[model samples]
Target: MANFNEDGLKKKLDDLNMSQQSIQTVSLWLIHHKKHAHTVVNVWYRELITATDSRKLTFMYLANDVIQNSKKKGPEYNKEFGSKLGKVFEHLGALRLDEKSLRGLNRLLNVWEDRSVFDADHIKLFKKNLNKGHGKSKENNSRKRELGGKHDNPQSKKRRDSASDAIQPSTPESRLRRDSEGDLTQFAVSPQSSTPPSDPPEPEQLIEAIQELENAATSDALVREKIANLPDEVSDVNLLNKLQDLAAGRALCDQVEEALSMLEAYNKRLAEEMEARKAVARMLHDYIAFQKDLLAQAEETLEEHRQKQGKVKKVREELKAHLQNLPDISKLPSIRMGGLAPLPSAGDLFT
Candidate 1:
């Protein structure tokens, strides 16, 4: 059970070279065990579905294996397995597998390919489900390519070339910031003011662009068109060269995502450091306050002792004064007072 954890699954995947065969076995176990299935899915399936396009193929293969194996398990178990497998397909569709991939799945799952297999609703749902799942990324990528082409236009190139020779060529830091913003700025049509705009956009404009991009980078046609027009003027020569190699398509998005990811990590580290410093500062503050309180208490106690000593001294002085006030016994006259008793009792009685 413990081995079913993320690390264990990760290690297993790594060990198996991310084999679909292994995933099928594990996923089957996860599906059959009704109580723990959701836990396992919550732990790993979401991540698994988002795996790369290649890994997606592996998942599709895994589904085929489940279908083939279901025959031996009888109709009730077969029905259950089919239902669970359908759920997985839904996940894949949500992840947006392409039509080609889905068609490949059709062949692999023996759907339209095998006459022996009864056509189920699940099978019928495949194409519809994939189209629904295909969602926005595909469109965004298409728009990005279109925009990348227009970006290298003669007019834009002229402007860039003119700007390239301008003083204060972009520093690496500024370039990185621009690339970072690129992720957030989706396509938009530039305002048709005849006047030539500044080579580098104003900071506020860049911020506005980023906000627009973040909001509509998904499927907005207008935003897509605007993003498509953005010049690929990243100042890092090496990175620019790489972007060029990727046909300047989705690679830019990848780089932007990467940069943002790194930035997030850096920000997280800074926050943690700040929190640690705050904790230390708090401890020092408490310690200093405690020391001040101790000093204050000690002074108060010392004053109390001094007051007691003063009272004792006053008593001593009074006692000395009273003793000194006593009159001298030698100087005083000696006073006599009275009387003797008789001793001869027997003789007195006879008389």
Candidate 2:
């Protein structure tokens, strides 16, 4: 509140080494990103920044200011750095910006510093920055919780001790990471006790854990298994009727059609196999009948040839006997020479 508000900040920036052009440049940049500029240091901005807890961006801002004010070696170091410039960095550090947050602050710091800062003393300077205020409220608010539970600071010894107990020692190592600005920061220090009481769980997480335990305690394994198998984001019992109706519509039809298509494909394959089997059977039957006919014809022809052979042999024997009993050969030949005998051609056998 004393040295850091929008007007204070703007005035501080205005007094710096003003190259005539930089004044316009900085003004235009501020106007264009005015909201962002404000948010960087706005106390009201903490409302959006904080979670459900009323705790402002206390630790986070505090951390950032410390790192930036420390301004040792990282940023541009040629120009002299200043107290107001240091204050702006401190304000940001108070909001918990760490080494990671104010990376751009280095170059910007060079453009604004009145003196040079060192890299070796970065950690020490940061701790000093935390001791300074950033125009934000800094009061302990946990007395009500540990003591008489009121909106106001309940005057009680036990609550005071509990709140004090939460305060961690600021060491070189611990201080580097912390920005605990108000009340007590959760990640401040490890407790000396062997065991610590765990905080109460959120409603959603507790509900899930209770359901899991109930499932585990069930006697019927099948019921437990079914519950486990339940899909996430299921249709609630409240919407069961709607889901049932949807199933009855196109969804059910799609399932039936898919099943029928599979059955039809199977039937088609079965029919084709039956036709192929029948065709093969017909071909086999015809082939067997043809072979039987061929074998019968061969047997009949062989029998006929046998009979003809017998007749031919008998005729030859009679002719030989006739010749033997006939007159002289020259006389018989002259008598039979009246007609010539005809012969069959050799090519006629294959036909």
Candidate 3:
């Protein structure tokens, strides 16, 4: 379980990863404390705002997981997260993000749209704020680039040109395009297929199934009543002595035999029903265990993917830094024709 307080929530957020297990574990803890949904969501948003850019997307994923999963249990999480999502999206849009992060955010938006996680108007507003932020960021970047082009010294310009030649220009759009083409490919092959486990019987179906056995071991009401009212001679040997004649004694013996046969049949049926109930119990146990195994496997896969994504991000950053420091080819001196010694004629060189 997780605490709903700001510091406790912040610590959880700090350790969060993009894994499904990580997201679900935190989501369940929050849902368990859903009485404080409003306070929890506020803390989540506050932590999200201060989180590193990479972790920001993870936080969004956590919110998405929680909102959807907690819907069946209660509306608290959904409502709380819904109210804050607009601000979250606006903040995200304002940041100049790499292509991957932007795509991840857009994908989450699309899911929300498709699932009707929030009202259309609210979703539309979130999108509006997101796009507005992106536009603002792009405008600022464009202005900066324009100013740099105008004011750069010759050496700086040459270095810029050399860097550009060494690697593609690092415009936001270019980076997005590059990431879309290259980096995103790494995520295409999942560590494991996400196909869900076979569903267990619905609660209603299980209830009905169990209910069917309520009278399984018993005879019908009329039969039970008749058996209960059986003549005492069937069980009491002393009643045999009170018989009026051989005919009466024979009649009593016949009744006793009929009763004995019915009891034996009823006993057999009870045994069969007992076996059936035990089988059902065993099946239910196995079904639950199977589902648990599937859940564990899925969690393991998510953890692997999260670790791999982290490594990829680290490598991408290292590459970017390395590209920035490439030598300036534009500053290389030109070889003038006058400075070069004349080449010997082919015949003289051969001689």
Give the top-scoring candidate (lDDT).
3
Query: Which residue pairs collide, candidate 1?
Result: 147-228, 186-213, 186-227, 187-223, 187-226, 187-227, 188-226, 188-227
Q: Indicate the residue-level lDDT of 183 in model 2.
A: 29
Candidates in descending TM-score order: 3, 1, 2
* Per-model TM values vs. the true structure: 0.27, 0.20, 0.42
lDDT of 3 by residue, 257-298 (tens): 899998898778889888878766865764565456557856
lDDT digits (tens) for residues 44-107 of candidate 2: 2332244322222232222223223323322321122222334534555556444322322332
- Which residue pairs clash in candidate 3? none
The models' CA-based lDDT, in order, is 0.45, 0.37, 0.64
The residue ranges of model 1 lying beyond 4 angstroms of the native Cα positions read: 1-10, 13-44, 74-81, 84-91, 94-100, 112-119, 132-351
In candidate 1, what are the lDDT values of residues 239-325, reduced to their tens digit?
Answer: 554545555647676656655565566556556656655554554454444345435545765886799999999999999999899
lDDT of 2: 0.37
In terms of TM-score, how similar is model 1 to the real structure?
0.27
Model 1: weakest 10-residue lDDT segment is 189-198
Superior by lDDT: candidate 2 or candidate 3: 3
Query: Which runs in model 2 stand beyond 4 Å of their true positions?
Result: 1-263, 324-328, 331-351
**lDDT measured at residue 249 in model 3 versus the true structure, 0 to 100:** 78
> lDDT, candidate 2, residue 297?
46
